[model samples]
Target chain A: MFKRLFDWLRQPLGLIAVGIVLLTVFSLAAYGIFLTQQSSAQPIQFPHRTHVGFGIQCLYCHPGAARGPSAGIPSQAKCWGCHQQIAKTQTSALLAPLKQAVESGTPIQWVPVAMVPDFVQFNHRAHVAAGQNCEDCHGDMTLVTIAENPQVFNMGWCLDCHRKAAGEDEAKLLKLADCGTCHY
Target chain B: MNSKIPEIKLSEEQTGKWGMVIDQDICTGCQACVAACAMENNLSFVGEVDAGYGRSMHWIRIERFWEGEYPEVKMTPGQPMMCQQCGSAPCEPVCPAFATVHSQAEQLNLQVYNRCVGTRYCANNCPYQVRSFNWRDYVRPEPLPNQLNPDVTVRRMGVMEKCTFCIQRIHKAEDKAKSEGRELTDGEFTTACAQACPANAITFGRIDQPESLVSQLIRKHGHGVKHLEELGTLPSVTYFKGG
Candidate 1:
């Protein structure tokens, strides 16, 4: 059977058919990955590693994480507080935008990397209060040069964590699975 | 017609037995609630043409019915009609996808827009005609979208949406309460309509709490009546009849 199948595959038509199948599979996998790991370009190339390496806490820049729905982007003033002194000595191409923003009093327009759909009401404060660290959902920024959504925000992915957290209690599991919990 | 409104026992252990009491006497028919609801929920404006075709999406609508004709023409007091958040919603069971389901904790009829396949079954089954179908992808059109409340989802075309009693506010209040490690105080939070009402006609609170404004209003007025009680929808809203 192996000899016959190999002999058939040697033919031009069989080879083309196999090629098509392989191409389709590869394209589908690529498309799936593309959808899950969609990332955007920030106005300024904000290096997470540099900030995290300096031991600047995530909440220092994103103070709203523990206080509100959004883990707010740091204002230009907040950035200027450190950048004003750091830029004087460092003097790099990347620090130019930060200097311009601080000098002009204009805010840096940051393109969000990790974004859930509008339907999903994600409360950062609630998650932070639940003893979940920023890195739990948003992968270790200390490792990545550019921030990217490391995990998919799909329902199954969310349920996997929620279900595990809820444990064997059916009621707790149902509460986690409840559409109103996130959607409403 | 049965003419009987089924009594619902408020569950004590539940987070809240949410209820609303609308004072028809005080309602000025200003349509503030309607506008507030639309803005708060990110309801799509269907424009004049679609609205003419009865495709307008107003979660809380002022329903004005004329009783008399000519010189004696008397328009009955305008009643704000939104989702009653029925105790036994007709829309719930008909949804094949289970998109519309009752939230036992809040006593709310939740319409999960993501799960909705726009079957229109839930809309048809709703006797109050509160659920509005998005006939087309209604354009937000530039600066108008800036006003949309971030908490609520802007429902897309082919999704059935209705009044959720401002479930977003309820969630926020609940979250705030939970973080503070205390129960939500009455009047600490309310629906957009109730909050925006110039006349203060709408009272939303825990009906289970005897001291709650909604509960007090219902009791003081000798149990406000539900609209179309004969239908046995057992709506959570109690409309106080004006003399």
Candidate 2:
């Protein structure tokens, strides 16, 4: 039966069918990749550029960056603190979700743009303490609305910075380069 | 285990960065170390059947041997067994994925779980039988998952895990010390097993530091034995024989 199908596939009609099948597979794979790359929809727009324009520091909203592993999303109360003082909170279209969430005492579900694999234990304090700017890995937040990863947070990317920071210091290099440092 | 292999000689002063001295005489075999290890490392609890079949995921185990005849049998003092964090580990060389390797800075064997392909070759090569493979994805229902230590990775099915000597605690202590711009003071922190031991049988610290508590204890009691030392594994943990 396979031999008969192969013989038929040698003809123009069968060749077109084969081409269609191949195209479908390729397109499906491409679509899957596209979906993975696309960021998940966030509950609130939370404009980084607008806040940054008013000279509000990144640490002002997400204070955990300097203190611990996770640079946690700001609570609704924290959001309400600033938004309550603003006259635009009363009627602005983009600020409606924040007003509703704050009134209902429901937290905003933030979709983290910059995320590493669960296996890779990324520490914000270590990176922040190393003299890395918030813009370094997280990109220039002042130019964008939502947070975007500056680069792919791969092992190679981490190693490159670590190696550079270590320079000629053999002990520092060993500690930084050790697999057990970030990964348990 | 090979008999003829020579142990790698580290510096005269430094045996390893981290080390433990466990006094078997003081241990009560209460399984406190086992419980502490499980809680600290987020180790899965394999069911009774799987555990009986030697699939138990406990990192630190208390070993008590039986002596004499059936009529007058005596249980030996409890001896706690864990990953020795071997200087020249047998498991390091056998990993096809390069998942298991020696940490030069920490002077310990490290198992990179992300890199591990569940080959089980490292576990097979281990002389002390410390490494345990995750046979299945053991679920932590509801609030049990909430109790997990965020520092340690909750291993999925097929990854090989073992006692890390609480590397997470080590890192946390070191990070704290670094932030404060001071060296990590001796006895500032310890492994969960050491901290939880009611009898104070387990002493853990920087063995290289001659002044550290673990080093002082090791020196005070120099007759301690390294399990399977003849294999040239150069285990970091030292156990004093109990009467």
Candidate 3:
């Protein structure tokens, strides 16, 4: 009677255990996909609308975009370069917080919008020279109000642009997966 | 995986292969290339102690290969050397995980640090002794983080990193070319070393292109030899002796 009970428990119960493991894995995968779709988080809602409508080009804020590896962020001094002469005091609620940071010689702690992983090399100089419009990679900022995560700066996205530019020839030109192309 | 498959396309039969001609005569050994490479590739530098322990990470190192006796002896300047990205690479097969592979384009060896488990099998097999290991995490001080190139990834600790021939810059240039709907012209995309060379000693371009500046330099300078030729590494980088 004990042997009969043991056999029954092993068959059905063991099947249930396997099913549980499979379910857990699928649930985890689904969760990861859902989280990824939520997109990257942003700190401040620095709208490009107010700035661009004022006829300010991207280089006004990111001064180093054309010449250097980095597109320099606007320091408090940079903000005051215009704001001091125009709006001496905080007129809008948004500019209020930054007013002190600007007037007191402190800087706005702006968070990075596009953060590339370590081991990858990205240069604005070469990109600018290659005739890539800022909008191509950064997306259509003209239509953007808040700095939303418009660009999906993934390896596939980078590779797609490279494959299109360098030609399909893997020997003469580079592809995205070419370890040297990205890692080194 | 078919290990022998070409990673990028380039005709093997091309004569006067486009190659950098490092003029030791003009090489100041300023290490601009070294710094440019570090910032461009997200290479993390270990402190002095770690560096003394052989963990200072530098992909392209300015190796001062000296000769002659003391007193009156002169330090014959040397060029910075990195991965040759050989046609037949020693580091390629020795990698247990196949982290480093050849680019089908210019025959550049691409070192994928993410896939590397840090067995350092490639470092042991490399004849140039160019591969560097990261002993610790490095941080760019405060606002200086803004100085980092957005194109490159910052490497973490305990990973093996090496020269990628600045393929990221190459890819960026290619992207621009595609957007413009044109072929990548010679001198359009250059490695940082080539660009920062004050003496114009370093030349970079598509090796497959017959009329490229690299090909022209190889023609002008008769001595274009690989670092360790007898080892059969088939290094894409060619060395030319100075006057």
Candidate 4:
């Protein structure tokens, strides 16, 4: 059957059909890759600069970061606590989503820009306890509107910093370098 | 994950950091450890058909043997078996992908699921027959999926997994201890199996610390034997075969 298909593909009409199928498949795959590379769509264009300008800490919104594995996305109520007090929140175009979400008691879906692979058991508390600042991995939040990944969160990138941090401490280096420390 | 930490030779004097002392005499073979292990590790349950073919994904299993002739047969004590976390693990050297490697810091063999390409080399090499491979991504329909532990990575198909000595709990306890500005106390934490055991058959803790419960148990009962010790695997689990 495959040989017959191959023979058919040698003909002009079949060759065109084969080219079309191959082109379609390649383009579809390329498009899929392109989609993954694109940043996820968020409900609101949250201005991190505005929040940071007011000296609001990252821990205020994502309090779970200090306490546990997940640096949790703050609830809609948390957002409305400040936004409802702000006068511009009533009329600002960007704040419209927040206003609607608050009025409807629905949550604004914020896209998590920074995520490590599932296999990596990243604990924010451990990193926070180690005195790692939020900006160390998540770039300058004050410089961007929506959060953006400054660098690829890969093993090499992580190890580079871990190695540098573990400098002279033998136990610390051993613990930090151990795969079970994070991978398990 | 191989670390830069110097590999310690498993001499007769060198006790591992984490160790278990399982009293087989008290073990009921009730399979609570097996159930707890499955629940704690997010292990997929292969149905009866697959399980019958020896494809069940139990991280810890209960083993038993019959003593004497059939007419006067008596069932021996239930023995719970799991990854021995050998200091000189037979599984480690056989893994081409380095997925099943010894954690130098933890002094336990780690099976990195993401690193495993399902070659089953490490599983084949394991002396204890503890390694369970993911033949397929077993389904847990509906609400069953919601019970999955968030701390553990829910592995998909084509990955080999085994008992991790409940490393998630270890990390959680360690993190808690660290935040509290103190060292981990004995009985502060334990593996799911130890916690779930009704008869208190399993005791797990720092064997390196002589004062720990596991070490004390070992010292109290000096007759405990490690299975397949002659192979020089330096298995961390000590079994006390009850009379």
**Best by the TM-score measure:** 2
Judged by DockQ cut-offs, is candidate 2 incorrect, acceptable, medium or high?
A: medium
**lDDT score of residue B145 within candidate 1:** 83
* Residues A1-184 of candidate 2: C-alpha lDDT, one tens digit per residue: 9999999999999999999999999999999999976556888777789899999998998899998888999998998888899998989998898999898988888888888887777789888999999988888888777776768899998999999999999999999999999999
The candidate scoring highest on lDDT is: 4
Which candidate number would show the highest DockQ if scored against the true structure?
2
lDDT of each: 0.85, 0.88, 0.72, 0.89
Angstrom error at residue B132, model 4: 0.4
List the candidates' TM-scores in order: 0.85, 0.89, 0.61, 0.88
| RMSD (CA, Å), each prediction | 5.1, 4.7, 9.1, 7.5
Off by over 4 Å in 1: A1-39, A87-90, A168-174, B1-16, B68-71
Better of 2 and 3 by DockQ: 2
Better of 1 and 4 by TM-score: 4
B232 Cα displacement, candidate 3 (Å): 1.3
Mind sharing the TM-score for model 2? Answer: 0.89
Off by over 4 Å in 4: A1-38, B1-14
Model 3, A30-135: lDDT tens digits are 9999997653443346668778888999987896777666787777777777877876345877677578786676666776776677666566766787688888
Better of 3 and 4 by TM-score: 4
Give the alpha carbon lDDT tens digit for every residue of A1-184 in model 1. Answer: 9999999999999899899999999999999998866457677778899889999999999999999899988888898778767735258777788778777888888888778888899889877887888988999999887797777778898888888888998777767777888996
lDDT tens string, model 2, B107-150?
98898999999999988888778899999999888889998999
